[model samples]
Target: MKDTGRFFTVGLVAAWYSSNIGVLLLNKYLLSSYGFKYPVFLTMCHMTACSLLSYIAIAWMKMVPMQTIRSRVQFFKISALSLIFCASVVSGNISLKYLPVSFNQAIGATTPFFTAVFAYLMTFKREAWLTYISLIPVVTGVIIASGGEPSFQLFGFIMCVGATAARALKSVLQGILLSSEGEKLNSMNLLLYMAPVAVIFLLPAALVMEENVVGITIALARDDIKIVWYLIFNSALSYFVNLTNFLVTKHTSALTLQVLGNAKGAVAVVVSILIFRNPVSVTGMLGYSLTVIGVVLYSEAKKRSK
Candidate 1:
């Protein structure tokens, strides 16, 4: 039984890594190289896919017990989370349109710094002094990386940073809004609800902001049928990314997830660079390395403090 459990966990971790990296690379391909410059609409597609898949998993397939919001307050809390999730995902897709995945991942590595800031401001949660100090390199590395990035765009950098901060904020807000035992939902259940709410919010925004994105996508499909297949595969991967992430967290500790996340970012950077042929300067590499090292240190500090 122990050996079987360990193997299952290893499989889940592998799936999590592959799906996470796959979704990111495909998002970059679709938005940047493939000329699908409709990030809001693309994000909407992702949410739509998640909504449908989560329903099938929980309702039809019985992956977990079906769950529903128990009160208006819980529904409102989920709505707030959905809004932040939309912002984070859309901004991230938009950033990929103008930035290399390597640079984007480097910017994303600073999520812990923002998470700490938001936690302190919103929840009055304070970490150990060592954990606070460890974030210095996380910020400094991004600044140094920005200076060295060869194809840096100001707008892309800003969007990427915004996405990172929004992600952190969502994490903090999730803790605050859903901390109550009665309100708490499992990750899959939370996603099942949040995905549909996100779609509800994203639909109008994409229609207004993206300006004929639907028509453009249809036209692209006519030109190459492969575009439709690419989108289907990409959207499916997005759902799997979330699913595997939840499974990994369920099976292992949050600290283990954090450590795997750090390694995943590094692996993603290398894979994206190789696949996209994005030029990386020595300074940029050094800065990214520094940021990753700082994150590892921060994780260690948190573990010791606990």
Candidate 2:
């Protein structure tokens, strides 16, 4: 049984890493190179795919049992989560528009720091001094990396930071809002509710911000239908990311997921640099190294403390 559990956990981690990296690369290609310049609309497409696929998995395939929001309060809580999800995905995609995947991921390495800060602020929970102190290098490393980044754009950096912070906030808020066993929605069910709500929320925003942009994409796609296929594949990969994340978390531990996430950032940077030929200065590499080391240290600190 232990061996079986270990094998399953390993498989889940592999799936999570592959799907996460795949989604990032696909989104970067679609948004930047594929001429699908509408990030918000692209986000809506991702949400739509997730919503549809999740419904099928739950209702038709019977892969997971259906779960419904039990009350108005739960609905509102889940809605808030959906809003955060929308903000994170859209902003992250927008950042990818102007930023190299390497730099965007380097910036994303600050998620743990943001998560700690948000946890303290929102829950009034205190952490060990070491945990707080360990994050100093994490912040400093990202700043150094940003300074040394050749492709750094202010708008992209800002959006990436916002996405990172929103992601952290979502993690904290999800824990607090879904603490009750009876009221808690499993990851797949949560995705089902959250994705649709997010799509509804993003509809007007996408129309206002990206409707014309999408129209332009459609016109461009007529000459090259590859654009449409890229968008569809990208959206499908986004759903795969959600599915893998849930499977990994459900089968393993959150700590395992966090550790894998840290590794994924490094993997993303390496893959992006190799595939996209992103130029990185020695100082930038050093800075990214520092940030990753700090994150690993912080994770260890949190684990030991617990």
User: Which lDDT values do the candidates have, in the order given?
Assistant: 0.95, 0.90
Over 4 Å off in model 2, which ranges?
Answer: 1-9
How big is the positional error of residue 233 in model 2, measured in Å on the Cα after superposition?
Answer: 0.9
Best by TM-score: 1
Summing lDDT over every window of 10 consecutive residues in candidate 2, give the lowest-scoring window: 209-218
Q: What is residue 243's positional error in candidate 2, in angstroms?
A: 0.7
Clash counts for the predictions, in order: 0, 0
Alpha carbon lDDT of residue 171, candidate 2?
Answer: 92
Compared with the true structure, the alpha-carbon lDDT of candidate 1 equals 0.95
lDDT of 2: 0.90
Top-lDDT candidate index = 1
